[model samples]
Target chain A: MHFGIISTGPISAEFSQAIKFTDGADISAVFSRNAESAQAFIDQQQLQATAFDSVEALCASNDVDAVYIASPNSLHLSHALVAIQAGKHVVIEKPAVWNPAQWDQVWGAAEKHKVLVFEAARHIYEPAQKIVRDYLVGKKPKTVRLNFSQYSSRWDAVEAGEEPNIFSLKTGGGALVDLGVYPIYDAIYWFGEPDGVRYFPALAPTGVDGAGTLVLVYKDFNVIITIAKNAHSDAPSEILLGRETLRLSSVQGIDLVTEYTAGDEQVLFDSKATPGSRPLSELMRFEAEFFCDMIQAHLEGNFDEARVNRYRSLTLLSRSVNEVCTNARYTAGIFFENETLEISG
Target chain B: MHFGIISTGPISAEFSQAIKFTDGADISAVFSRNAESAQAFIDQQQLQATAFDSVEALCASNDVDAVYIASPNSLHLSHALVAIQAGKHVVIEKPAVWNPAQWDQVWGAAEKHKVLVFEAARHIYEPAQKIVRDYLVGKKPKTVRLNFSQYSSRWDAVEAGEEPNIFSLKTGGGALVDLGVYPIYDAIYWFGEPDGVRYFPALAPTGVDGAGTLVLVYKDFNVIITIAKNAHSDAPSEILLGRETLRLSSVQGIDLVTEYTAGDEQVLFDSKATPGSRPLSELMRFEAEFFCDMIQAHLEGNFDEARVNRYRSLTLLSRSVNEVCTNARYTAGIFFENETLEISG
Candidate 1:
């Protein structure tokens, strides 16, 4: 599987490096607004891929099997539509679109073109996530809390009255969308779509949530998703698995999943996950491996009914997640550029 | 101070044991519905207190200087009122009353009698609590979360369709009153009264809250109080003191108060609060020490202006805390016996 990495941003560089850990998957092309930045990222990553100045040319390249969209939050729809229309499968960034309007447009094009579109929610593909998912099969917990509050590196920039790309409304970047997406996805993935969603954002000076609490109400129990970009807390996220408890060290990137019984502490995940832990770049390998296998099965006409259903459910899950995040942020009085959709919190 | 302990409940027994740790404080009298039960408790604790079946007889005993009201939730007001009216200082248990109306009645009587009325919110008087309080001076946190959840021992009884006193509406007992009081008091004790409060209760089969989430809205930040009695979680309570984070091992009884900086993990509390750690019985010693000092100062008329102000502030704080808890519970669709004054959540 060949991935044409879009944008020369930090995440794009990660995707470029992520291919190293996967089997026979390579970056065939790279795209950037400036040719120099694209070339530089390629050179830094020691990639054999061609660097394209225009996104159109990158999508049009014959060698590219799929285009990995690592663009900003607002540009996800435009970027993916172009790649899908160019007869390429697309692996989009975590949140695929800003609102349902864009969501409908992107999926419509993907369906029309008969191409796959995957949201690169990295943690969902990790082996650790599978352990939790398997443990939650019949014995579902009533109470759950997923926290992914990391003090943003760009928070200093926002504090200095500068709109770092992540802290800007135009870029569709805020704590809820950028950092909240992980826990938001985790909530939906593990416990289905909440019956209702309410967000309490710690709004920033640049009109974005610096940190916030999300009350996602399920039928019986409530899920509290704490997300932040301007503050940090070491509090473990919790899930009460019947009588016992599963304490996840983190929601974003977990290394420790501790389950306590009447006895001592039982560490669920077998491995240390990584020796020194995989570099940030290699962390994206799991998502790449998943997307490549699914897309390749379709290309080779070897996709079974089970594989088809799996891919379909994943796309639908991404669809629901985008709705929850968009609606939650909008309800909390956080609107992207020109977005005025009023969904009650 | 010679104290008459009301009721022969488990808390009353613990109070009798806790007095052993206090200076010149002992159970001068014991009250129970049955004289055998009162006499049995006195024998078990090896106390020289007189056992009284009649509540009036216990309160009217000349040997008792103050009464520790450890009665059932519904009986708290009646028991405390008897003690207060008898010219004895009172130490009522946590969540003393269910509604603001009850709060008004209890305080009104306490003021008229000119006696010290303490809530016996044990954690507030702990040496560790003072450490967190002193550290919070001038450097308040932006996002705070206090969690104290322990699966109740009586949960099996509730599951068996039998209403234990802790799970009964008539007894003025539920998760919010039973377990939620600790975190609620912690919120008010550290941060002042929240501007607004909203509660989302996970109601039990017996129409009482088995567990719940309390959203306490402060001026610049929101404090989340996650409490449960039907389940357990080891998730640490957090207080983001400025840039550094303070992780409390447990809000109910903290053994670890960790503060993290740019360098290494800094354990905040200098000494281990206890060597082998105090028993649950001895945990009540702090509250006994506090109430006894205030009451003893008043009895000798050696109560200086500072002592007067300290006692005044404590009662005022308790007054605010009661209002917050009662209002929060009422708003969350929980109304105790014959009380339904709606405050929307």
Candidate 2:
């Protein structure tokens, strides 16, 4: 898989580094608004890939098999449409978009072009996710407390009276769209859709969520999600079953996961490396491998019903998470500048 | 100070045993609807205490100076009033009362009798509470996540199709009233009154909350409280400061507390005694000593304005927590029987 990295950012750099750890995936190209920045990223990473100043040029490159979209969040739909229209697969960053309507446009274009699209929620592809799912096979869980709070590295810029994209509402960015997506994906993919949702965000000085608590109401239980971009939670995320529990280091890149039943606790996954789980590049490798495998399956064309169902489920889960997160954020008075300027949007 | 135990339940037994750890406090009387039960409790603990079948007899006896009201939740106000009206100081269990109105009645009676009233929020009296409070003295915390979930011992009876008082709505029982009050008190006592509050309870079969998430919204932060009676949480409660964190073993009986600042992690308070703390009785001893000290202060009427201020602050905190917990629970559709029959009540 030859991937064309979209936008020269730290996340795109992570994607490039992650691709190196995969079996048969590599960065074939890079894109940035500034040609110098694109070339600088290419040089910094010492990649043999071409650097394109335009999304169209990167998407049209014959060497590129797919486009990894790490552009500013509000521009995802527009950038994704360019890639999909040019017959390239797409992997959008954490949130597909600010809302489902925008995601539908990108996803519809992918289906029309007979290509696959994945929201790069790398944590869900972690082995701990399967362990957590298997741990709850015959068991019913009542409450799940999922948290992904990291004090943003760019917060220093904000403190100096500057608005980084991650803390600015104009870029469709906030704690919910940034850190909250990990747990939102975990909750939806594991427990299915909630009956209702409510979010109470601690809005930042720049009119974005610095931190927040979201309650996903189910029939018998509530999944509480805590997320932040200006503060960090040292405690691990956990699911409280009737007589059991599953604990994850965090909702993102879970390197340590434990299951407890009665008087016993079993460590399901413990990487024993990196204080905050396997390094981001190493953990992100799983998503790269998964996406490459899916692309291979599409190229192979002759697949069984079970394979089709897996792909369908993954895409649906992605869409559902985007919708749930966007709607939940709207309830907390968080709004994006694109698609809808409506207050209660 | 001589104390009377109201109700022969587990909490009453704890209160009686806890007195043994205090400097000058002991259970001198026991009250129960069944005389045999009261006698059995006194006998089981091997305490030199009188057994009375009625609240009137126990409260009116000169053998008791204060009444430790550990009766069923809904009966707390009535029992406390009986003791207070008899000129006996009172130490009611966690909630004090279901609502502020009910608490007002007990408090008023105590004021008229010139006797002290205290909520047995033992956790706050733990040395760890002072450590956490002092740690956040000059710092601003944007989030505090408090969890006190214990898989209820009485849940087995609920599973056996019996509505134990802790799981019975008729008894003003639920996770909020039973377990949630600990975190509620921790939040209010440490952070003062929240600007607003909301609770999302996981209602049990008997219309009581089995587990729940309560959000106490401060101006710049949200105190997220997680509590359960039908399940357990192994994760510790934590305060998310920008560059520092304080982790408690749980929101209650914090045996271990660690503070992390920059690269240095400090063990602020570790009892080196018990896993969950110096046993419940040992922790409860703090409240016993505090109440006893307060009683002595009142007796020595030559006290300064600071002493009066401390008493006023403690009483106001008790009332504020009662009001906050009651209002928050009502939002989650939990209600007690003794209070107004209003649907939202």
Candidate 3:
């Protein structure tokens, strides 16, 4: 399938490169707010795709089969709606939209147009999920702790008086939406919606979260999601079940998953092919490939049962995550008018 | 200092063993509700002391200079008061009292009688405190996370229909008081008191917190304290100050303290004297010795400055921790009638 890229950000480049590993996906068009940036991105990537000066033109392109929205958080709804209304499948970056209203609107449009809309939360497709599933085959988790914290390189630039977009509350940028969403999505995927949610955010001077810890209370187990942009955590994320534990070295990008039982450590999943092989630098490609397969399966109509299940799961997960984020933000007293949008069926 | 033992439980034996390492402290009396249990304990430890049938009898014994109350949580206030009224200094086991009112009452009695009251929380006297202090010299912490979770050995017995005191809500037996207090004390010692506190507890079938996570919000940083009696956590507790982090391998015992800076780990303090020694079991003796020295200094009127500082610090910590615990319990909606006690000035 041919893919259209939106925005000329670093993530778009990563997505474009990752498309190389997919079975049936290629970048056919690129979109940027300005013509110069679009032309530059095309030239830099050495792609045969046409450069579109506007998202409307990109959505109008007949050469593109699906559009990948990598725009800022604030623009996700607008960009995704345009693509979906144009009868094009859409692959949105993590945090497809800030609030449930936008989520419902986007999905409503996608359903009306009968197009697939995928949230690009790649961790769900990683081998770590399979490892966790296999580990918890018969057992039950008592508690799950997920942490994804790193001192962003952009933080130094922002500290040096540069206004990075990520530090701007106006752009729907905050540690919770930007980084915390990963662990939130992981929890939603693994445990479904929580019974209750609470957030403790360290809001930056820009009125955005610089760091935060979120507790998602489940019936049998509690999930603690810790995320930060101004600091780092070296401790691995963990899932405790009685005396057994499943550990992921990095929650942000899980490269290794280990299980500890009876005081013995066993590696369940490793991104590396061999002990001495070059580390997997293009891990994001796994999600891209998975999305491509999902899109292909959905379009071909060969596996209706599997396709329906995937759609239902994805829709439920997206709605649950968006709702949890909304509740947490409100509870923390960091009110965003749009973020207060209630979940709608 | 000759000590009178209150209650002949497992902790009493542990305390008796630990008292052997103290400079001038000895178990001079053993107290139990029944004379048979007290005599058995005395015989087992081979103590050259009397076995009193009642706390009142032990308190009246001139051979005892201080009383170490190792009774159940419900009886700490009354036991300590008896010792205080008898002109004996007191060392009460942790969760010294469930509520601030009980704490104030015990301290008021001790003050009125001109006797010292100590809460025997062993972690405070460990080398971990000095290591953290040295590491954070002139620096402010951005965030601190402390976890102390262990699968209780008594869980099986409790599940088998045994009403172990640690699992009884009527006796103020719960993870928050039994195990959570360790990390709470750590937070109070390191950060003084937080501006706000919240707890999310997973209550057991007995109506006590089986496991829980507490968030203490300070002005510049927040502390996350996780404690469990139903499971275990292998993640090292961390104190983050900018890019530097001080890690404790075990928050409850802190066998090793490591500092990480710029991607390097340095072992700041290790309980092991040699590289491969047996690792200093019965480390609880250090706290007992510290208490013995404090009691000796206070009684002899020596080391006035050090004694005063230590006393003042311990009092402040105990009060702050009790206050935080009260607020957290209320916020979590686990209302205990005793937990609603106001902090006395």
- Each model's TM-score, in the order given? 0.95, 0.94, 0.93
Q: Write the per-residue lDDT of candidate 3 for residues A1-345, one digit (tens) a residue.
A: 889999999889878878877777888999998888998998898878999988998999899889999998789999999999898999999889887778899998998999988888877777667777666767767778787777777766665876577877667777888888888988887777899898988877667777888999988668888887877677888888766778887765676788885458888888774321323326677788777887887667654787789777888887888889877876787754344444322
Q: Indicate the DockQ of the complex predicted as candidate 2.
A: 0.64
Residue B127 of model 2, lDDT score: 85
Candidate number of the best lDDT: 2
Tens digits of per-residue lDDT for model 3, B72-131 = 888898899889999999999998988777889988898899888889888788776777
Candidate 3 residue B173 Cα shift, in angstroms, is 0.6
lDDT of 1 at B13: 83
Task: Looking at model 3 chain B, report the run of 10 residues with the lowest lDDT sum.
Answer: B273-282
- In model 3, the Cα lDDT at residue A324 comes to 94
Query: Local distance difference test, per candidate?
Result: 0.82, 0.84, 0.80
Query: Which tens-of-lDDT digit does each residue in A163-274 have in candidate 1?
Result: 9888989888888888888888888889898898888877778998888888888877788888778777766788975468887877856677778853458888744664
- Which CAPRI level is candidate 1? medium
- Candidate 3 displacement at residue A253 in angstroms: 2.6
B88-198, model 2: which lDDT tens digit per residue? 888888777878778888889888988889888888888878887887787777688998888988887887888988788778888887788888888888888999999
Per-residue error for A210 in candidate 3, Å, reads 0.8
DockQ of predicted candidate 3: 0.48
Residues A284-331 of candidate 2: C-alpha lDDT, one tens digit per residue: 888899888887667678556776788799899988898889888877
| Runs of candidate 1 exceeding 4 Å displacement | A273-276, A341-345, B241-243, B270-277, B341-345
